[model samples]
Target chain A: NETAKAELGRATWKLMHTMTLRYPENPTQDHRDALESYFYLTSRLYPCGECAAEFQQLLKKFPPQTSSRRAASLWLCSVHNEVNARLKKPAFDCANLDATYDCGC
Target chain B: NETAKAELGRATWKLMHTMTLRYPENPTQDHRDALESYFYLTSRLYPCGECAAEFQQLLKKFPPQTSSRRAASLWLCSVHNEVNARLKKPAFDCANLDATYDCGC
Candidate 1:
């Protein structure tokens, strides 16, 4: 169960990070709203109840950074690290995010 | 790039399958709408352009079977197999779906 949970977390994170990385550099307000709504909806519907609750709380505290691709990606990286810290996992260097999450899409 | 794309695909699929498996057994209209909207939004915002196009086409063709958890999960399983066949991958036994995707959440 724990393994499944962790795997799901990793996959969700990968998808989200890649999404931000590929977000339009110069986004319109619609794009920004879409991104924000996507996150909230994701939290609302995430399969894991506990994780969803935690994510909702995180969203309330951190919100989402939707100004630009770099901003969104870095904000997600930092948020992920916060989750990592809560899980007693080592912090990932935010600087390497671009290289790490290049989905080549 | 292909490797990254494939990895992203696997992760996305995992999250999606687990989600369907955990969906409400007797869903209300709101739940059904949310599930359908989630899939549409995911295809729209999927980072990979080609994959997203294919997904959109698939949605149009198959739509979402949102009446119940079993319907949703089986529908997703069949859709995933369709993707696998297109990619020349072996078909998965749909009967084994519950065992394969126990997220323990």
Candidate 2:
């Protein structure tokens, strides 16, 4: 029984290691969309609040470019959801899910 | 069960402090492509033959990623894997999954 306990302990250890990931359960349809949204946002790396403000302004400034305008929704959400697993914070709140990104980031 | 074995050994020390992640099972991709690879390369800093060869050549030239590469994988397959448990690696390894990293930097 001790031997089996040891073996089960070892396996649990391995799974815990897997959970360190910061995002979501991932590889899901929603997870994929969220990741895709995140990649685009991180790629943008808007350097200032003005850039973010300008992001929303563009639609109003040039309402004709609807595709870019539509993308803003994904951008807002991806920017909000947050994860600080290194912080051992709650794991489910989608870090890149959108406008919820905390200043604690 | 030993108070459920200290809450299953602190939940198996938080699931072996999580398999300590590497180059797989991540968000669809990374930002820098380089980070898409490994910030720590705890995964593929290279197992050796060129860069891995020079790693092989360099390590064979100089040999071993040293206190470094190749065998950390071949080596760590220990208590977590076999024969090295009495070595009580994870009592240390429980806090150490070094060679395996999110590497995505």
Which candidate has the top score in TM-score? 1
Stretches of candidate 2 exceeding 4 Å from the true structure: A1-105, B2-66, B83-105
Cα lDDT, model 1, residue B56? 93
Clashing pairs in 1: none
- The alpha-carbon interface RMSD of model 2 comes to 17.9
Candidate 1: where are CA atoms >4 Å away?
none
How many backbone clashes does every candidate have? 0, 36
Per-residue lDDT for B1-105 in model 1, tens only?
Answer: 899999999999999999999999999998888888888878878999999999999999999999999999999999999899999999999999899899999
lDDT of 1: 0.92
Report the number of the highest-lDDT candidate: 1
Interface RMSD of each: 0.8, 17.9
User: What is the docking quality class of candidate 1?
Assistant: medium
After best superposition, candidate 2 residue A13: deviation in angstroms?
Answer: 12
